[model samples]
Target: MNLKQEMSHSPQTVILHQHPLTVHTCHTVVVGSGAASLNAADTLHRMGQTDIALVTDGMNRGTSRNTGSDKQTYYKQSTSFTDADSPLKMARTLFNGGAMHGDIALVEAALSLKSFYNLVGIGVPFPHDTYGQYVGYQTDHDENSRASSVGPLTSRYMTEKLEAQVRRNGTSLFDRHLVIGIITTPGENGDPAATGLLTINMEAIDDTGYGLTLFNCRNIIYGTGGPASIYHRSVFPKSQAGATGIALEAGAKAHNLTEWQYGIASTKFRWNLSGTYQQVIPRYVSTNANGGDETEFLEDFFQEPTPLLDAIFLKGYQWPFDSRKLLENGSSLVDLLIYIETQVKGRRVFMDFRRNPRCADEQGTLNFDLLGETARQYLTNSQALLPTPIERLKKMNPLAIDLYRTHGIDLEQEYLEIDVCAQHQNGGLAGNHWWESNVKHFFPVGEASGTLGIYRPGGSALNATQVGSYRAAEYICHRYTQPPTTTDTFLAQAEHLVQHRLKLLKNLVVNPEQPSNVLAFQQELQRLMSRSGAFIRSRPALAETLHRFQDELARFPNQIHICHLKELPAVFRVYDMLIAQIACLSAMVAYDERQGDSRGSYLIDHEEGTHRISHQGMHFAFSLDRDFRDQVCETFVKLDPPADSPDTKQTTDAAVAAAKVTHQWVKVRPIPEYTTWFENVWADFRDQKIFDEKRG
Candidate 1:
């Protein structure tokens, strides 16, 4: 097959339901425009696989472009001359984060520098000293100083640079194209493998058949990010409605679906309150819903100011809410207290940078000398022992203050409303060392892939995204470089699915009296997930929650009625979220049945209530499970045919009930203990046998 000629082939148009739908045949379809997706296209092009197209919901949207902290971290192998770091040592650090596969960890570590330098070569501007060594700092869960950054918008720079490279490489771009489904057919082992994608072009949504389009590809790099659209309280950009659900419905398994990272963030302008924002020690205050009658809330819980001050300072690097920190007056108590004030008490919480945290004994005065050793030393080192939080922030990181200003916020004078919100998912679609899923030819990279486990170093996600894309692209070039299935063969397999979807689409528009309730349904889904499936879970409440979600799932499409053709994208998005939510809730219920305890970032509420924390006048109790960090929770969805309904032809209620989701607990794969003997390893490298190992 001539790769260059394959890249030049234009899409063929197929008439289905009297609509001319465009079908582009390619070797690979990279589904997303984020850093990982763009890097996949560019890397595949560089590796000589030119027949690829980049499809995305939006060009300038995604967490990678819109989200960050005061100084967003990028975890990599230490580059400082004084630090002792190697691929093996770094792999151990990542592998020690419970439930992560050893082979993936090793691959990520082994290729960390190669990925980092690739970004550098593309002009990402990672900081380096005069000696040409990239200096680093310590981030959460990291023992060594392996973190680096380019200010708060590190990922933004990365996306911009990689996007430029991808455009320069002349890879095809499908902007504003939402992937509604993954087309699959039986492959090598007679199991379903990714064959193509079914998409809707938003630009032509008002046209006939709602602008349906298709991609006939041999492989797919799924990088649509985490299932952020599932939660109401999320830091993910509004545009990032992840398409992981469609893949799950296509027979992909999920790993560690219950693990997530939640942190206190400014609710008004969604951004993480990590690094300098917390280190400055701002006052935690709450007010009535109308934003009056302000009271210093944290003062009521702490007898003295030092412990409270120290906790707030630790929130800088401590960042994500860890259940372990909730015990013994640790940093996570701040998140719990805030959760109680805002969620339980029905009040609004904010961080007032203008004033110091108040205490009964302190009398509204902050004494730098009374702070704990950690806080005192850190502040002293940064020369930030200033009077107020804003002043300290201005001195420590002016960029933090400016970032908010760009978003119509004046942090210097106004209060930053904050709440404990979902920041990132540690779990997502399950994949192997090369980022390939259980279904052959489908690769989930970046946050879309559940590679990271319970506790990852702060910026390791950025690194993993790059490394996973490289591995996926490399694996494809080496062993899977074959021409895509003929268009006729693809149409033969996809015709029925396309016709079914078109029937649903026509029904949505033709029934004008039903009205489009997409927004309302989305809000309802978000509320359900945030209440039951965020960082805090109640075992008894989850069973009922799962039942409610299942019922909703059963009533989908019938329950959803859109009046216009333009609302098709939103209708499909809600459908995707519904599928994803059911599987996630199922995973949560399974974990609860296994007596999974309060560990990592979430707490499990149980009647046993072995652990207790008191906030305001209310006492909350939770059960603790024995350590199961060494185990991985994997989930798979089995699709059953829709049951027959006598009243209506579209019995989606039966279809919802047909999705039988199941989960299992298995021991986590250990890091490979392989021989490093040079000559022996060289033989395997020569034979290209290293990539074939299935140690994980």
Candidate 2:
């Protein structure tokens, strides 16, 4: 359909076309329709708010499957007699995963058992034992029986249930809609409160052209998923498109943007290529042309003490060097070395299912006992996959069956592949504990908010989405005393912004360039990041890459071409590229300034006796742009030991002594203080005229 025709036929599409010109009466508008957004809408309804509308790209297939299965398993495991885990314990485990940087109150709320029960009440079908006890299973990063899954498709299932609930409550949904920007008003404290949203109805508009729409809402919730798409081969759907970029462009202060996780699944051969098929391989075993080996690269490199290893094993089946312990004990250096070695060896690593007996059994249970039953019914009734039972998948993959049959590997296997995935980006629109962002009336939840702190434990994602949604809705219901009118000034500003974006889009369409010009530069950028920024970072490489990036930014305009008037697609893609650069640069700075040995994902040297060696030290170094120039800074910290205990000093001393390290804090001439250094850096960057040049 033509853009105008499509917009005229659909209510949501029409809203977008008229947004710039129409003065919308403000109501509560949720920007995503995931679990978080649905929960938020539900909360608003419960709190007696009727004028609520949810805007989302569409019902996300991957997320819905994951949530549905996760919810089912969570309920089953929580009520199982074999599982005696408590919410308090779950909360503590989550806090440790985040290195104690996460908010305690938020963690506690997320772990509440009632949250799972609430999901069951909302039409989530959970697994149950013969006695009606809920069945549960273990998953990544979760210490207790917190995860319950029908299959890998739990997310999709949960999303469907939640969507149904939202629909039943009469909460309006704008499907296939993309938010372009946010409207905010200056509040009493100089904070910009979100007043409404500008969106494009992608489904309604023709593929060739689409117009902008305005959505006036009292509160906005951002459950826009993660920025993994910024990387070429993320597990998430490409449809995600990093819409959060638009929010960031609209003046959102995103934190932890630098903390994106690097999982082991990335294909080493095709590291820099987009659309390359990548597998989420287990990390327990390393395979060469010879065969599978049982050596744990991570554990061996860290030279993890038996005590720590024992503690990790006891916690659950999957604990890959507790980041909390590494941070406290100053032994992250060792961890980094191992990861670097594994990557350099050119061998694909798989989680050694042989060591962990529970791995196969768990897979079987998920496949047969849970999803198997459903598949059987479907196949019998509909002749799907032309198979009577899908359980035959176990035999199709020899590695899986061999581990199960020959080795007697059971579902509760002791070891599994545990690698970091770009799970979530916690930094997006700055918000308070109540979910209100810097924008007075705007709120963010899920991966779109930075309130979750640096690291999130498994299952916490579900918790945060549900809790944040409910909390934000509750706050808005009480704080929004009256409906907001579309004032003349607001309409004028919206019109101007819309016109500016339209003009930019038009310019791009009329001036198309060869694809190779843009593709070559993109490939070069990806190659630079893969070698210098992936897995490990060093001083010289970082400095060199930043210099290269500066040059690229200068030439980007000349090298790239745009052939569309809808700037949203091109703008979003560019933003992703920029964010990727920012993430890499941040990692480089952190690695460069950090003097101690590398730990976790960051490694110092590839092999033993190399020029680089992971050092053990009390302080970690990081660099940030303050005034615009990069400045290195250090913060004294301990990772393994709890920060609050009296024995912290003794623990730090012992850890340092074990590593045979000593340091003398000497004051160099004219040492810059933190504030002054930041100011100077910020000023330098601003004066460099880079931002202006890029904008132009």
Best by TM-score: 1
lDDT of each: 0.85, 0.47
Candidate 2 on 1-696: residue-level lDDT in tens? 111111111233222223323233447777776777787877787888867777776666334332221122232125567877654455555544432223433333443556667777876766767898766656555555656654434455567787777777766667766676677667676866677776666644433335456775566777776554444423344345455545654555544343444443323211110000011112245555355554555454334343222222222222222233344333233334335444456454444323221222343232222222433353335323211111222322223333233334342343322222233444444455566665567777866664443345545566667777776776677666567544555555465456544544433323445333444555566556655654455567766876676444433343455544443444435534644454436444554444433333333332321232333332233322121112211111111211243555433222210001111222111111123367766885666432231221
Could you tell me how far off, in angstroms, the CA of residue 272 lies in candidate 1 after the best superposition?
Answer: 0.4
Candidate 1 lDDT by residue in tens digits, 1-696: 221233545878888767788898889989887789989999999999888988899989888999999999999999898889998899999989888888888889999999999999999999999989999999998888999999999999999999988888878888889998788888776868889899999998755667899999889999999987999988888878898788888889899888889998988888999999999888889999999989988878877778888889999989999888887778998988888888778899999888887651255446887789999999899998777888899999999999999999998879999999998888899888889998889999989996998899999999998999988998898878889888889988788668767766655534567766789989987988888888888886788888887777666666776777778889888888888888888988887787777877888866677889876577767765664778889999876656777756545432444578988898888887766799978997788786783634
Residue-level error in angstroms, candidate 1, position 306: 1.3
Residue 622's lDDT within candidate 1 is: 73
What lDDT score is found at residue 138 in candidate 2?
60
- TM-score, one value per model: 0.96, 0.62
Error of 2 at 417 (Å): 14
Question: After superposing candidate 2, which stretches have Cα over 4 Å from the reference?
Answer: 1-26, 61-90, 98-111, 130-144, 203-210, 266-316, 319-421, 426-429, 453-455, 509-534, 539-559, 563-570, 580-584, 587-696
